[model samples]
Target: MPWSPALKSTLRSGLHLERTVTEPFQVLRGMLGVAIVLFGALALGETGLATSAALGAFIAGTASYQRSFRPRPVLALYAAAGLSASSFVGYLASPWPPLYVVVLGLWAFTAGLAWALGQTAGVVASTTVSVMLIVVTLPENVPEALEHAGVIALGGVVQATLAAIWPGRRWGARRDALADAYASLAHYARRLRHDPFASFDPDPLMNARRAAELTPAQARRRPSELAGMRSYAERIRPVLAAMADPRVGAAEEGPQRDRARELMGAAAEILDAIARSIRSGRPAPIAERTYRALTVPGSGPVLDGAGRQAALRLIGLLAEASDAVEAVDRGDPVHGEANAPGHLSRPGLRQLLPVLPHALRRHWNWSSPVLRHAVRVGVVAAVGEILGRSLPFQHGYWAPMTAVMVMRPDFSQTYARGVARLAGTVLGVVVATGIIRLTHPSAWICAGLAVVSIGGAYLLMRTGYAAMSTCITGYVVFLLAMGGEANTSTVEDRVLLTLLGGLLALIAYAVFPTWQTVRLPDRLAAYVEAGGRYSAAAVDAYAEPTEHSRALLRAALLEHRQTRAELLTASEQAAGEPVRHRGLHTAQLADARSAMAALGRTTMLMEAHLPPPQSSPVPGAAEFAEVLREQTAAAARAIRADEPVDLHALRDHYEQWAQWLPTPAADPADEPGGAADLVYRDAGLLVEALEGLDSALNS
Candidate 1:
């Protein structure tokens, strides 16, 4: 009944189509690539070439579906080259079952390792594996392997050309991302008005920020800008919660309470205006008004000491938010100094060579999900290939390919993909058979249908994985028919072998599964450790402002981001695991996610308030900074040991800081010495959030 269940429900509801089909451009891009490849093959009077070419084009198109700062042509070239290499290997070993099985296993291992790199690389690698599985069945002499590979490469070129033609709506995507972030802030604002302790749903905004991160670093809507927006939103949450405390606001009809409510109302309106401006490519209409309201004379009405502190903090945060929104008005980066870090760095050849050993040492392990996946997929595929050869399977590749496709790293998705593949295969075989029987189309018509089927498959890919599978299954059947293998026997064998492969995948996973939830503790601990370092860097920067401190802060932030990504992935994989196999229940996972989000927001706030070079720094800043850093490290240790964090000293520190500004002070908000006091108050909010997390963990 608590917020955790509601949070879990919100996440799971995305299994429906709304979250799946984010944009129509992806489908369009994929369809154009397949159409060009198939039409070209037809024009050349070689229906047989359609199979390899279409496969190559489709895979390449899929790889470049999400536009990035990396040139479309470059990404397309890599995808094409990989596909061509896979085709050559598959064709060369087609006749020798023993050799083919060995090559397939090696390919699986290398391709599986790609997953450790990132999502885009993983997609390209998996599609290459798929290309190999399909092309191996093409009846061609060993010498023609290179020629087939070349044709596949040509298909990749065609896709690249299409990608260049329609480079996507870049600004529109940015607007949508920024809009989502502002809208999330608006949602939190409304909630704070009623329940300060309301659960914060960070997924929508974080996902939007990630989507923006996929764009080029030099893009107008940069990752740093999105990050700044997220920080502003996060900074306000705890402050508003603090303000909402009954002790902070006077009884009914009090001046301070009225002022607080007015400030919240104006802030919510400004957030909404910012969201609209993002969507409409216009300036935030209320930015000036909001700034005035927040900084106006007597903004902090007479209130208790804690109430004044909360009010002052809120005013400072609102002022920062106004500046950010104004920058958005001019389409400028939120933080000019902070470069938006890429999801993965592109190192030079020499740099990469030296780092390979470290990379291998980090990722190559029995406990790693990617390594286990490589082993599982390779072993199962080899066994499947052997059995397919021994049995009277018409298309031996289909069996092993099915197993490869269905066997994911997580148990739930592995089982789900198996079921989806089976259902799709059966439906496709029926549909293809009926069409062949009723129309009896010529080779040209069959080729056209194959192209159409491929197009439709990609169009529906994001809508539902099963729907995409259904279309792909039909396309393959029709494609083989075009290549002169349209016999009823071939059709029957395809259906039977596909079923066997799916069953094999299920059995293999049942025997030895890779459960992400099992490693959640280690992943969470690593995240906490990274977060602690980031916090330490930030506090250290405050105490001793220097270029070196700033660099350390950036490096620590990058580390934390990477760790956070891993934790998010683990949480998702855990969600997909079966209940019996899950390491933590739904509520626990939600709690962990909430804690991590709070920490991330707090870190961003620290970055926002990082002090510039100070001639004479406040003496107390050093002591306070050390205390903050120590608390952060203590938090990491507590999480790793699954113990409640000791926060009694932190509470006392907050009380001492609150004593700096009392009620009825002369010019409390405008005092020149208020900078340190405001920072102390903000730190108190962060400490409170940490205490909330400690309580959640204990509960």
Candidate 2:
């Protein structure tokens, strides 16, 4: 009976079993949240209080899990759907049921039709499907359910609408998020200068990913607003690469760190300027001075001797890139309009048609899933009415829809959600029993429990598995008590129903398993394209002068970030895949990211020099800079991807471009749309990369 070594270690850890218990007030609040939503329906005008509570708890839980709600335009819209659905179900239950069914049914059918025909099919589908399920599961004439639904839906709509238009309407919200993104990047850069390699893991990538995922819609879209998030990513790629360099991290010398730190400080200024511009709704102009500074480049932070020169060159290139962004914002023609001359990489929506099948074919149940959920709702409501007909108990459709709502995207999530619900429901019943013992609780008690319930839901959400159950368990008890009587005595029924819902969700997640599935071949094809982009951008980074160098780096980072995101998505799709091994999928993710990171670093190092121009180009050489830019870009792609570049065609293009650069006759302003404005100096370095490729291969 004595403690074993492991047991001794655990006991010595000073952990107390009592710490696992929740506070009395906290427990009370959770019950209150459930009750308010159930009862609040009477006061809120439309969405039943119960509907209000459930949706509110769910959203609050979601926000906590995401850690932020910056990506709100759609999220808010989704909440609106949840509210409307829950409310409609309420109406369908009692005083006038057909109107509720009719309104909800029409809404779904129309939206579903629109989704089948629109660009934003995903958004519409997400809303419609959830709404339809809730409508079918609403509780019937459970005393004031309609009133509850109205109030709940109205409350949600108001909050979500405000959240959606917040930055545009809430004065400084946009500015705040932008400033935060920059500040975070600056802090990251400052830390990197000390030990670039020390933080070489994917933490930065993860952070950037999180920031992009969390930041609301306001930060990603303006010409001035980080260029739809692509530019902000572009600006950071070189920095991440530089830090990733083994040599950069290898440099323990004080001077080396100091120089990189200084360079980082300067780069932060550019980020800050961009942020300010976003706040002011002004064009993010790259001032002439900073534009001139980004010309130099180095593998690591700027060091002494050549390091200082590289830093200056980087500054120049950064400045020019910034200017180009500003130009785009100002509608300037130098960098072209929407098209980066020489190499037009326009969208190919037609190509997407072929890919759609790859995505849609994987759906769990292409048609029946939605219909099945609807039928379940109808049946549950009808049965509940019959069962409660002879009994004093009230019943409705919530039981069925509740089961549908809690179903997992896959078996894993479904298992966890189901377990949590059962646990939470049981706990809620205990709370209701306690309330009954305390004698008929008042509205204030219900409200108080509601708040507590919300807090618990928020905290538990991230814990997964047990979260939904923990919070919802308490919620059910509160809702039962809201019927003007301390129905808390009927806690057993609520718990049993929750148990029923969990079992149903498990059945759904396992039966047809559709949440995460994608075609392996298509995913592989996308990976090839992503790798190509990274390599191409790296090659472009070798261009001389500041302007082209920055552009290449920018392009490299954005492509890599996107690729990484896709790879992860693919991994999820491949989760529990019957035929594929999880390890191989994970390996694909690693290989893709490694190549991307390496390309980023090497490009930064190669473009370190910003030498003065050689002589002008030979006759017809004006276009050489661009064509060569594209060739290097293409070559880089050939290196990383399965798709080979047309080497001969690319070589001929560069050869012709070379002949056009130095011997320029036409005015650059009139030459062509979307061309790089490189002078004698910039064109000279690009030639090195072109010639280097030529010598390395074509020789």
Candidate 3:
């Protein structure tokens, strides 16, 4: 955790270029919008207006590439509106240097706080800050400023229009998300065949759930193949785990275990087939051997109890998948239930207006990283502007603009981005300036070159921030050249200004840091609380088998998955911090993570054997479930308070519940495979997991 090592790590991360799956058609489509705005402005003989409109279109196009489930056109429009408003206000205040500085600080602060909404919103809002700085220097009067703002807004309109009319693949992102979930299941199944207790990553399922959210109109027009499929994928996961687990399904090594392995292998193939079909929007071509393996024969080795149940459930799920694929091929309206547990409802753009204030208010606290980041951005931006103006640079606004664009809430990102931005600016300025001096291209040729640079930027957006920044620098250089600003001094000014801006941003974060290490305990407590809810919900379902209980269990499971993901992400980010905290040593954190995983896996095993509707309720389960929830909630609080995590009450309640239940029959044939028996057996494992957690925390 030394500063030297941490800095080296962050720099490597910054310079690393990722190999992403590039969609050429989509990149070209986004570029078309920029080309239209630029060329149209050039035809009208307004170079200044052309630059403003192209900048707007380029930023809006970049917003569409962000990882969001919302419609691309809507994102474009939102970015456009922010850009237009920021540009107008910047021009209005440019006459008074003091007033403009205040406005710039306030605007940067608001843009930073926009992270409360999401990363997409934050990035788009930050672009508005840059636009305000860049475009304010162009307009000479009120009428011309209005004209520039209108043209910039028009650029967004063009991008939105193109997105709506020329969507490359309808429902493509959603299809890929769902496909990835099934693909993950296939990989899990394969892994389980070799390692019975393998852990599954829930990220693909989470992405699929997000993709499933739709506006009312989208929901109505959704494809039949997409309906009810995600629910099937979700249900298949726990069952797969149940079958492979030695405790719940087959013994360690026997005929039953071999049969379980075969079934799992077959299931993996079927899942892969379904994934391929879903991704391609074609009929699933299942293999004959896979079907034969799943089909029950009269004389094959018998899978009793939980193993038997899991096999039957998996077969039914596979049938449902096959039928859905056939329905897609036949072009039939398969009226299967589309509602899944923990499904989210996304409101339309207009509906988001009323809730925007509430969303912003939620992050208006000292503890919130977003608020701290906003303050840092505001102060740094104002200081950067002041320093830039004090210097002898021709375009002083470049310095503040760079600071606003590169700054993030965390240390790693702010430093990494600062490094990348500086390096990229140097590379871009050298290459672009060299080209202009060598070719001495006309204004029209410079405009064309700017268009090409924008296209390269769009294409390399996912590669790395550094590569994209290089392209962006070239694009800006060419655009400015078209306005007759391409002199030898331009390169020196741009590179030095960018370096100054990046250093200011980095220094501000170092002074006012928001370390993820400090928040680790809170994130761990959240995971513990969510795990408790999941365990309680699973237990409660045994006490009363109803649709309501099922829904609660599903919701709890989703919450637990989300919390686990958050904890893991926080841990990764915290790893690179220069400061080392005192609480929770490395071993203790690992033990805590292992204990939580064990707890969730045990609860999932119980969930796999949930009773059917109208089944008799298990005795004493309701009281035990209540006790489990209360003890876990209290333990979470203790963890957050740095107190011992005592779970004696939960363990005591479980012991009493076990005593109240009737003893299992000695003969294996006489043993019941009902919900009551399964609940009794799994509750002991749940208590053990809780005890493990208690020990990990108290240690």
Candidate 4:
């Protein structure tokens, strides 16, 4: 295949139109919000009010994809507050030139600070910024501002009501998510059966996990179903990977291999059936044949202890997956484990006050990317605003708005997005003009098109910002036409202003840049630290059995998983970034990734071997747990400080735990019946896993 510049760009940015629609319901829900606003505003036949309402719709609509575990009413209230606040700020500042620039700049800064919260918050903040740009330009008088405010408020209320009424296929999202989870397992199983050495991509599994994560507890098919689905998904990946171990594969290639392969094939079929059932929104009976296959005794190859253990783990995971599906179908609580409680609760006015100082301190420091980006945005937005007002371009808000949207925290992202933004705007303008000239649509048609474009914009948001920008530009064109003010000249102005704004954004980022390549090590260190804490928690849970200890283990595990996911995502971003004047050592980065993967496998095995809380643990278990904690902490510190980790010391220290393992001649009757045996087995597994992780890191 010949490589073109466009192809290179697409590959570098991971762009593909197929991903434009992540969730069909999210797009439809947002479109419904816009449609409602358009319907209400068009019925009134007031252009000014319609314009204000349309802006409000777009603001609220863009946030339709923000998912939370919170109740609908709570989330709606939060959305309404954000809409009202952005509208008010924009309206209050437009009359005075200096105040307009200063306030808009400050708003940009505050929106930038929203990145501290997470991706969803960042999306909401960006939408609010765009809303401010539109609302502030709607006349200057006090009466006009008040009227616009009223209309905007009405629009927001309409959106909130619509969201509550039709929240877009709740069951569909859960169904798709659960199906995807099963499909991923099936795919992995097939691959392992084909070739033991073949690697699997984690993205599909991660996406499945993300889908389940966003699903609200009440919205799920069964109690704790989403959580159970995610847990099973996590456990299955490592177990499959373990089953693919070359030693296990090489040990039995005749009858034993055939039997193992047959079971895997059956498991895959069962998973596919479950996925199909979920997709069809029906409860399908578990296949009796598949269950029997798992239940049948091992009649094949003799195996070493390690191979036997791997085979046992694979069967156990398959059974676990089967149980999860049955539990979902029965509408029973899956796994019987309580889902983790909310990490960050919805904040009230009083709650905000206590955390204001801490939030400020956390986000206003030099080490904070959000703080640095906020300052960059503030300065550049002020310049863009001044330029927009100085230039005699009509609808001058485009320049400042474009600048606000294009500028990102890092230089690479900002520059790449700026290029894409400029290109997309030009293309969108041309396309919109052509459509208008050919169709000559009426106001109602224009209104409908505007809503459709808004939906497309959000649908493509994740694939690439440039694609989203193209849809948004068309949305703006149609929206203006709905207000009876679009023309060929309008397209020209939009294209020119967008280019200018994009250029400004690129220059601004160049002037004050934050490079991800430099920050990757720190992020990797954070992942290491989180992993260590999680390992300690897992070990401690065994040392003492209590509800509190279990909760801590869950929390630690969740935190570490999140951090590891973050590291993986950041690695991709850094890898794709244009490498000019950067310290992105490819070899080192690969090592980091490999180490993380190894650590993940170890964590999975540890979780699998985790024992129920015991009345008393082995005396040496505490010492082994300490070894893991100290070793992992040391590795994190070494990575952060750019020092080489000494795996020899870690290995030497962990060797003492080898005594806990059962000897070849040992019998089960010789050990304590329950707690002591469980403790010994868990401790041994944890120690060995830690050693494997340590070796991977050192390598």
Candidate 5:
């Protein structure tokens, strides 16, 4: 169809609006960075000040805004480190000579400390770069490089201060994030209600990601990083319990709709808590409490007699699961909280040692290997940079950037990184070379490009390590040209260096021979254990399970959901692991997801007919676990292809397990019939191990 005059006008209007939106932040940040560069030589961190200023201008948009001003202390600590290190370290090593190299151990020590302290990435980069730039490595042009570092550090400080002062600018974005995340949750819950069969869909992360992605605007709007809330899914059942069960929701409002409403409400509240904490810059105590509550059977009373029996029985099941989650959280080496409290008491090396008992620690997945890989990256980066400087290639030293990109978890990442490095370098070098070759742009132009590189730096961040390098290259190229290095030969050198950097990155990645396979199973098991502990808390509460147990469970569940996210990251990383481990990884992942669902389902059943806390043993609560454990044993045997589980053995264990909770009244007319018509559902998935080999297995 032919375009109409109206359409043309609309298109133009849209373009203008888009351009207007993009210009200010981008332009201002660039200008600020350039100004900082000019100032830092005199003032200590000119670039940092500029970068921080430019970043701070959009202060309203940080994750903290959602919390109503509460910031995550963890991230805050990092910013503090970043800001202080500039001043503290700058003073310590002044008049830093150009082309100097830091000792290997010092760089490793700094980088390792950051990783040890829980900064997995950006901080690690900062620390290594700090060592290379500030400690040992310096520029061919000392004055200019020092000027740049000072400006960068200055930009960072200004940005940090600005963000702390005003969070409202980013409040809307934070709010959007909460809204979108919940909206996705609601959609999924609704789907589950409509088609429980959808559980057969093996790839939940994909589904969740898809659901979130479909509403791009909403996903983008979430204020909390939430970091792949797989554990949070455990809480959904409790939220569902509050919604679906009459006692939890409006009693007279009717069960069908009220359950969903209450569940959605609880979820919203939790999300709100997250948002509120982020925006306010305060931690969400309620979020932590409510999340913990998710592990236990909800406090709703058991329904009419028969339903009540089922609910009571389920209570026992869920409580056992709660115990498992608790096991993971408290003193279990797997989750590492055991070492947290004792950190100050022990030697650092001892503290780093695995604290979980052997049995508990056996459930290892590669994801637990955070510290090791971080050290690897730091060591490699420092070593490669030192090597690069010594190389005969007087023109280009590309290894440091390569080391940064390749250092993460694996090698599958290397090729793309290589490509990105090469591409970004060439692009940046060309941009730098041309400007210097052509007529000079104003100081404004120079400053503006510098600032634009910051945004480009953030945008291209995950895209490639070379992106940051590119921006720096562009700035350097512009500086070179400004100094009249505009000759054809200079342009040739620029291209050559850029190419060499790309090549060097590839070499570093390859030489390291990293692989993608992440230790997913180990991570998955940790989540399972956490989930199990949460589940057991409900059961163990006996008659008077306190809110404390409930709170603990919720946190455990929350922790579990967080792992669900890492599981996905591991899946990507797993591409390089040996084939044998991959299957185990998959099984473990499946087990975790399944265990979470089963655990939640029990909580839901309990919510349907909650018994008073520990109102007597209520019959077969004792045997319930025997049944579940038996089932698990059976399943294990099945995996081994051992002799079949003995029918007699299975039946006996089932009977005992089946005996949990009070039995329903014989006559409907005599009492409220609790689930008499419903078929019995086991609270936990049962695995049947071969009875014949039981003795042999023990041996």
Candidate 6:
């Protein structure tokens, strides 16, 4: 990928607007918080206080809109506290230029490192830096600075108060997340009708799982329908895959295959109904025809063997899902223990104190991308600030603020955001200046316009960085206008400073880039290791079927899914990067991806036939499992070191294990689709996948 084409593609992606569904009610709720702070302060004849508080309110509201499952009031309060602290520190350091620059660098570095916590934390922390830069210029003395900081904190209080008292659609995010999972399953079922071997995406289910994590208080009041449906949804997925797969469940071309397709279609309909019911908080009536399709007919050709087992399992899951929906309609209390499977737990805010240090330490190492990002941002921010102050611009903080907002951990986002921020600032400044000149709006009018702009920003938050950036620019312009800072020259200065800041951030990244291409080998190695663990766990379950083995298998499966998702994300981001490192090429990447997929699917097929607890143990299965784990772990280490993945020893071990296995009965009918036969067949498939992976890596 050449620089010219890569740059063009990144800019275009940055400028592209997403067709996001706007939530008018949520937007209105967020706007109301800003309105309370802005108008209330203005009514008291405190223009400066109004400006400070409005900044806090707007930023806190924006935090609420981030993709987080934490309580909205908690997010608002955290954002507020960070803003107030940053503003105080910035104002105190403003008297000494050198000290302030050093403090700014440290703060920016910490903000960049916050990415280790998650995107929501990283984004909100970065905004604190931007707010500090803007607000430090407001107060003249220590007392004034304290007063401004107090007001800013008050802004967050106001937002949090409103969110606590007037929460619209309580637990809405959870409902939507769970609904999305079932909806994804519905789509997967429909796709399986034609493409029986199609892969089911785990993203929605992962999101739903995150959403399901609840604090102690939330667990006490959770809705009954939300309690067990997610668990059932997770179980249903593998069963659907097993039913659709010819190797494990149905024959390729027979009545059993037809029955599998019919069951899948019915399952899709039922899943959609469940999704709608969960999302809308109302019971969706399942059609009689759909219900009848799940029943095994007495007079027609019936499914048998593995296909019948799959159908029975699917029917049972759907029935449980339907019961949950009915329970929601009845307003029943949630059943089962709080620590049940599929239900995740999150510590309360105070409980996080002991965990924060360890979390921070994880990303403090040189190998961490977060650490590198922190270093880059710290240097860039300090330099940008010095340059902004030296230049003949009235509001020099705009330069560093732009740089902080635009810089990200990856190349594509950093450059894309830089382009979007510059374009958005230009449009916002021009439009705002024109309106001020034509309308000659007063301070109060400006405050009102600022509120409207913030509402627009909230509504467009998901419509791409460019669209939201435009609204945010307008919001900032109007807020400043209330303090008598909206003039033609100000607009020109803002646009020019924005361009300069964007250039600084872009150039800094080019000089100190965190190329995803270089990290591709690491990501691939992680997936391979996770896949091996999953396959080993699945095989080990047959050696000693027990509650503990099943638990280990479940954990390994989750880790495998997470690693696969991470690899896919890294691949997508790396595709847009211009650098072509000596890692894996395009063809090798594709082959490796296919091999990993096959590895996971083969294990899943074997998992579908795992023997019942206390069943007779398969001979040499435990030894084979240990061998698989060790060989794959070695392969992963070799991959990370950019060495060839030699799996010949693993294949040799598999052959030895196969020879040690007990022979099946002479008649196939005696034990059709037996556990031993399935294990042997899938073990062979797993070895083939490892061989393919080795070939791809060695090539």
Question: Model 2 scores what on Cα lDDT?
Answer: 0.44
Clashing pairs in 3: none
- TM-score, candidate number 4: 0.82
Query: For residues 1-699, what per-residue lDDT tens digits would candidate 4 score against the true structure?
Result: 122443366345533344545577767777777777777778888666677787776665555555543334344445556766777777777778899888888988888887776666665676677677777666567677777777776666766677778766555555676678778778877877877645556555555654544333343333344445566666666566555544323234665566557667777887787677667655466667877766646653343343445556667776776665566666664332224421122344466577756776787888677888888887878888898778877777788778887777765566666777777777877798678878989888988888888888878877776688788889878877765566635677777778788778877766676756567877787887787778777667667656777778777866776787777767765654554223335666666656555555445544544444655554555565677778778877887776776545545655555555445323322332233443444444445555554555555
Report the poorest 10 consecutive residues by lDDT, candidate 1. 336-345
- Name every residue pair that clashes in candidate 4: none
Candidate 2 Cα misplacement greater than 4 A, ranges: 1-82, 89-150, 157-180, 183-258, 261-309, 313-402, 408-412, 442-444, 455-469, 484-490, 514-524, 537-559, 569-592, 603-699
Candidates 1 and 4, the one with greater TM-score: 4
Per-prediction TM-score: 0.79, 0.54, 0.97, 0.82, 0.59, 0.97
TM-score of 3: 0.97
lDDT per residue, candidate 3, 502-617, as tens digits? 99998898888999888888889999999999999998887888889999999999999999998998788889889876876667777999998989988878777788767778
Candidate 4: count the clashes.
Answer: 0
Task: Tell me each candidate's RMSD, in Å, in order.
Answer: 5.9, 11.6, 1.9, 5.1, 13.0, 1.9
Displacement of the residue 448 alpha carbon in candidate 6, Å: 1.2
Which of the two, 4 or 6, has more lDDT? 6
lDDT of each: 0.67, 0.44, 0.86, 0.65, 0.40, 0.86
RMSD (CA, Å), candidate 3 to true, equals 1.9
Q: Which candidate do you rate higher for lDDT, 1 or 3? A: 3
